[model samples]
Target: MCSILHIIGGVMNIAEIGQKVAQQRVALGISQERLAKLSDLSRSTIHHLEHGTLHEIGAAKLFKLLSLLDIQLKTESEVTKPHALEMASRSASVSYKTTISPQELEESLITGKIEPRTISHLATLIDELPLSLIVLVVKEISQRHKIPPKKIWSHIYSWANQFKSPRLAWQ
Candidate 1:
């Protein structure tokens, strides 16, 4: 009996929390998309919350919207800061910004100032160039500049395609 009591006492239940949020949304008869627009959050966020994808949404953003809609966030003294859920949510929100442009990355390649391997790594991370697009850009630069860009272009192309922006989920 003591073991059963302990198991029930220590369990953290978030189902009631989720239900409360859904109840509010349903009371207003507002769709997830509409709530997203009103809260300046992505539609997926509202969808995930209603469907109980709470792990994908950060506690900060979730509470933010709850506050906007006059909903309260409750805790049983078991909550902790900076959960994995928060980190995952933040990953989807990060945008890519590069120090150089596609033209510059290609120019560095053509000038022989950059190693082929370095260019490959940069292409994967540049986001703007991607792999296929990088090849086109590099080929154009190599042709106009009289550089032997043959296999290098195709190699980079294959490698760049493998990268998937994890942040795109939130976008």
Candidate 2:
């Protein structure tokens, strides 16, 4: 849920929000030290955001950081679905005939810019990847559950976070 725009309300300078988020992190028992290491975000970015000093933090970086701290800016419950599914009466046949764009993956990391749903979307793509890299993921899950690879992958598909991928969280 959108947190009611509660930005230390009123005209403020840089780093104010950063300070607030940082304070929140501390309250949650996450120190700047650990957050930096785990999130790969600088202590200064944390510092700057809290103080509102970050001149221009792209949406992607902002969400990623907030996600790491367990802060979700927007809530999907407030949004409506596309309604396209209702028109679908027949099963769709998809073929893994396209090459995956490694650049799409790299851009998020390099630019720190991402869309709201991008992370969760990518999580599905990663889990669905049929190439060799993902084969072992199914194999391992199958071994642990004593199920066939197809069944294990089916379970994984069903259990994937529907609202959003774990984002860079589990990376």
Candidate 3:
């Protein structure tokens, strides 16, 4: 059965798409096997798709599955959100005379070792940047650096407390 989901906007990676699909399926109380049968896909495909482990699926198959699940993909002309590194760098640069490069910011995040020169910029980031952006940055850095996001968040929490940040996200 083709269910209609209105236009889903924004730039979503495959994993995020898979997550949405999984949530929809669960919300509908549909079993993976049932969805697979209805969509003419394999149960394994459903599992992998839900878990974000599927490397790729044919466009036709994906469309069929999404149709059954009532998800319609739509593209928008708007500019996409900035990358995590870029957001972090720009936020850190705000209110600072010296700008922090994306590379330096990324290195500091991954290593949990802030350079003396960039301390002020990092402090600004911890103090003023939105928590959502911080989470996105942590997720990106964790994946790229092979470190757990929890460890990165711990470092951020420590920095926030040390800096006495007024941002509610840090609190």
Could you tell me how far off, in angstroms, the CA of residue 99 lies in candidate 1 after the best superposition?
A: 58
For model 1, where is the 10-residue window of minimal lDDT?
1-10
- Taken over the whole model, the C-alpha lDDT of each candidate is 0.50, 0.48, 0.79
Which 10 consecutive positions of candidate 3 have the poorest summed lDDT? 1-10
Report RMSD (Å) for each prediction in the order shown.
17.4, 16.6, 12.1
Work out the TM-score per prediction. 0.35, 0.34, 0.52
Per-residue lDDT tens digits for candidate 1, residues 118-153, read 443453443442343443455455556676676445
lDDT of candidate model 1 versus the reference: 0.50
Stretches of candidate 1 off by over 4 Å are 1-16, 77-171
lDDT score for residue 47 of model 2: 66
Candidate 2 lDDT over 1-171, as tens digits, reads: 222224331233336457657666877788776777777778877766776767877767776777766664432331222221211101111232332244443333234344453544344444444333334444443454466666644433443444343534323
Top candidate when judged by lDDT against the true structure: 3
Q: What is the lDDT of residue 143 in candidate 2?
A: 53
Give per-residue CA lDDT, model 3, range 74-115, as digits (tens): 766433344877988988898878899989988877677888
lDDT of 3 at 146: 87
Q: Sort by TM-score, best first: what order?
A: 3, 1, 2
